[model samples]
Each structure stands twice: as C-alpha cells, then as structure tokens.
Target: MIESTFPILEVADMQRALAFYRDALGGVVVYSYPPDGEGEPVYVSLSTGATSMGIGLTESPLPPGNVMLWFYVDDVDRVTTHLTGHGANVIEGPVDQPWGERTALITDPFGTRLHLAAAISAPPDEE
Candidate 1:
C-alpha cells in the first residue's frame, strides 16, 4: 500500500527561503536541482537533522498559515535572530508558556506564520 505524499511551502524566491532555512534554522541542503543544466538551482531542499523539506518557485496562490506546519527547534534565540537578520518579522516573542515551552511566532516571506518552540528546563533531581 502507498501513502500520500505531503506538500511543502514553495516560494517564488527559492534562494531566500533556502538561505533562511539553512543559515537560520541550521538546516542542511540535502538536495537541489540545477536550472536548465546551469549551476543555478530552480529547486532546493533542506533538512533539520532528520526531517527534510522542499522549496521551489510557483505562481499558484498560497493560503494563510496553518497550525500543522509548525516546527519546534532546540535553539529559539539563534533561530529568531537568524530569521530577523534575513528580513523575517518576529510577530511574537520567545515567551514562556505555563505548559512548559518557550515559543515565538515569525512571519515568512509568503506571509506564512512559523511557530518556533523549545522545551522548558526540567526541575532539578532530588537528593
């Protein structure tokens, strides 16, 4: 039996998204396709350790942000700083939640809201 394939956020500016994902989120470019045999790429891929994603340019319309695509990272500060440096707007802070997680919101180039999250510190062990 075959499961269905998933979709990723394909942006018009693939290079910008690639840079943000790699430089900011610490994702590695695992795969890329050249543009008409030229060195330049028309499509790109990035992986956060194990999870992989795709990026490409398309004229299709994109809808608003959905909660399902949120990616939780280990380093919130680094991620926030990197995204902001590359022109992303931080919609919300690295605020601590009562449920024990530090979270933040960022607006991507395509107006997609990305939720950045990290687990809170654990309590010290008893003696």
Candidate 2:
C-alpha cells in the first residue's frame, strides 16, 4: 500500500529553485544536503503542510514543463497573483470551472507547472 508520494524535481540551479518553492509557494526546507565546499545544495526536501517535495541538482538536461504540481489554496486569485509577482509565468487565468472550482495555472522559473485551485461555494437549494 502506498502511504504517500513525494515528487522530486531535477533542477540546474538549486538556489533559484529554492527561492521559487520557498518564497512563492510558501514551502519550508525541512532538509538539505549542500555540497562539501561552498556551493549550492545538491538535494533538498521541502514541506508544505502535509505534502513534501524533493529538489535535486542535475547536470543533464531537465524536462521542463513536464510534471504538474497542484495546490489547493484558500484563495486561488491571491496565490496566483503572489506567484506572478515572484516571477512565475501565468499560463492561464483564475477562472471558475463547471465542477465548482476556481483554477489558475502557472509555471515557475525552473519550468515547473503549478495548478492552483479553490473550491467554490455551493448554491442554495431552491424551495
């Protein structure tokens, strides 16, 4: 049985990636393994409430715009604005969906796609 799953993203620059995840997404770096000398971190684990994500340094070409990281936020518009201010490209809008959710799509500086959504209020039942 799978208890939980952690997604690991390979990045070329760890520092830049950290800024995006920590600052933009409001994630905390729970653990990190920096290089032996004065250099960027090779691996880092970020925790956002119950979810955890891993970031690793890679020299090979990274698969940009591949995986999508979906986040359920209290306010989709607010979070999308915050991310855009922090250099995240807005791929789509904060539009209301037929399924009763407001969603927004964005891509971080490291080319990681982020999908932010918030549940819409249910309409009152007609008497």
Candidate 3:
C-alpha cells in the first residue's frame, strides 16, 4: 500500500506563513512543535480539514514567482471577499470559465497565489 501527503513550503518566517495559511486560506495548524535548542522548528504541519501539509522555515526560500499552492472553495465570492478584507490581493477573477467553475486568484502577503474555485450548483430535475 502507498500513501501520499501534500508538500511543505519552506518559509522565511513561520508565524507569518501560519497566518496566511490559517487566515487567508482558512487552514488549521494540525501539528506544531516549538523551536529546538537551536531555536528552530522540530516539526510543524497544517491542514485544510482534509488535506495536510508541512512547513519548514529553514529549508530554503520560496522561489521568486512560482504559484506553489492552490485552494478550492465552495463559494468563491465569499472566500475572496473574506481574503480581501484580510488584506489579500485579488489578482484574477470571479469569472466563470468554460470548464464549469467560477474561479478567483489571489496572492497572499507571502506571495503565494491561491486559487479559489466554486462549482456551479446543479438545478433539480423536473418531472
């Protein structure tokens, strides 16, 4: 058997990263460890209820312009409004695509582009 986990992002600051993940993206930190003797994380992880990922502050800096993470939501308008209210920058739309979803792209303070997608609700079939 095999199992896979989502990737971790190396950050310059742990708390800042945590804020973006938790606040802007609505994720919760499922596991975290305080700094070791060297004052660095032993381990830390976050989740968006179903998906789990890690964070390592010491690994390396995130690339200059890579959209490394994406988040899909049930309501793009509400989520994007909340994120924008929280100071996230809206980069793209609440535009409907031919693929059948309304999507909006935004960038966090840490420069991660988060894609908010909401599938159009289907109407009930009439007899």
- lDDT per model, in order? 0.73, 0.86, 0.74
Ranking by lDDT: 2, 3, 1
In model 1, what are the clashing residue pairs, if there are any?
none
Over 28-81, each residue of candidate 3 has an lDDT whose tens digit, in order, gives 777777733556564578788678878778656666356456677888998898
Lowest lDDT block of 10, candidate 2: 32-41
Cα error, residue 103 of model 1, in Å, equals 0.5
Cα deviation at 5, candidate 1, in Å, is 5.5
Q: Return whichever of 2 and 3 wins on lDDT.
A: 2
Candidate 2 residues 1-127, lDDT tens each? 9988889999898778888888778899888787346566899899987899999899875778469999989899999998888879999989998778899999988778999998996744668
Give the TM-score of each candidate.
0.75, 0.85, 0.75
Clash count (model 3, backbone only):
0
